[model samples]
Target: MLKRFVVLLLCLLLLAGCDQPIKSGELEKVGLLVPETINDQVWGTKGYKGMLKIQSHFNVDVYYKEDMNSEMIVERAVEEFAQKGVNLIFGHGNEYAVYFNHLSEKYPDIHFVSFNGDAQNENTTSLNFEGYAMGFFGGMVASHMSKTKRVGIIAAYEWQPEVEGFYEGALFEDNEVKVEIEYVGHWDDDQGAILYLDKMIDEGADVIYPAGDGYNVPIIEKVKEHGLYAIGYISDQADLGETTVLTSTVQHVDKLYEVVAEEFDNGKLKAGNLYYDFSDDVITLGEFSSDVDKEFENEIHKHIEVYRETGKLPNE
Candidate 1:
């Protein structure tokens, strides 16, 4: 009996020291770096939510540093994380990927993941969503809901995959719907987005989608002020007013983090590019808002049904 009890105690100790991966028990230490504050409620906030989801599910320790843009600052932040023996590091924004990739090369022992940029190194990986698929669905929804047959898009930058996705989605449903696109040149410039959106509204735009930073809140609110409907991104819960949020192209960041954490824990982690498309159900559509007409909303719902069932919508 004494021998059996000693063996049981040793087994318990071993089990306590081992982690079951991203699921739970024996937390693993991971670090996350962001280009902006999580309060941005757009891209940066999405990243924060993803990290939080990972923590909630798994026995994982997470450390975060936000509001870093410069290469030098990011480099220092990553280095500090490495010194602290963090097993995995996440660079939240696309702009920070390049620097993180460089650091990954210098410190091959660490595993690094980038949300936007392409993953090129053996020690680093990239994960991205297929914005085009979401954009296509958004366009279908906008086309059916627009009373004026006019929809407008406000993008923070001209070159991002997300911007292109929005453009393609809007144009897919009706080629003649008069979809207009504008670039504000900065990610956080809500004021610029509002100026552009107001101009489009004057031109008879009844629905506007702005893909800027946290400032998008102001732009959407401005649209509501003019009695126009608005769309959101990253998720559908974005509330600017009563009956606000026509829908959203939500990024399944929580799922991404959970899968990546599992791979890291299982010791099968590899450096490569990871892409999730709408067809894969990683990017999803939210509910249409009250501002949309019932008849039009039904039309949009039909398309959503197609997306849910067939994973494809009619051409934008």
Candidate 2:
């Protein structure tokens, strides 16, 4: 395994280190780098759909590489796409932003797009969603539905804006509500997330938010098996069960991909960090489950409307 790693690393380094000038226009060819398989039913799948959307509507060829778990693999994907004259590459997760920034100077002609991070180079663009609003509303649902007045969130990291949003939103809805947060160390650790879920349930949590993209589905399934409620994350998960999910905090990343394609088409695409929120319709709350109280759901909608119109959340 080490020998293979060394060989792959050396090959990719050679490919990327070559002083190849642009063989194509800035946006003529597009590439997508996904951290996991495209069939994961959440983040990666959304990313793949976004790539397809760009291909269908824009006058560009699209390429994708999945299961990007290592620095070597990432470099290999980028180098492979670069060889194909892909001057524009989209890293489907924030995990790629730093790597993109690192490669920015080396590949000055390549433009990189990724999520929720700072871009240090003129060739990199960081896309952020106003996740706080959705998290806050999700918190409200958890608090409202919890007979135990305790909720939990299994997040991959503390830097995620939605974690803070959910914490504060729960308290805002009910000051007595207790919120538990545990990180599974990374995005795809389903077993670790399950352990955290078990701990939360034992600690009196009646509702939980499984916020890790790859592991959330299994965690929600566990929540259902435990006869608890959950505030779904990333995708609309109300279909999981009628009473299992309260409301899903949806991030329509596919639509954001279309936005990027449109920007490229219109010659407005550039390097920088850009944020989208409820007003842009990028971050949203999905349909309320049948178990969600009608009155509480109405209140949540009112809060969303006020925030959309005035750019102020209730806690603000």
- Assess candidate 1 and give its TM-score to the true structure: 0.84
The lDDT values for all models are 0.75, 0.89
Best by lDDT: 2
lDDT of candidate 1 over 7-91, digit per residue (tens): 9999998898785533433236788888779777667777777788777766566888987888899889878887887868888
- Model 1: lowest-lDDT 10 consecutive positions: 19-28
Q: How many backbone clashes does candidate 2 have?
A: 0
Off by over 4 Å in 1: 1-27, 162-165, 293-311
Best prediction by TM-score: 2
Q: What is every candidate's alpha-carbon RMSD to the true fold?
A: 3.9, 12.8
lDDT (Cα, tens digit) per residue for candidate 2, span 89-183? 89998889988988878887788998988888888999999888889889988888899999999999988889999999999989999999998
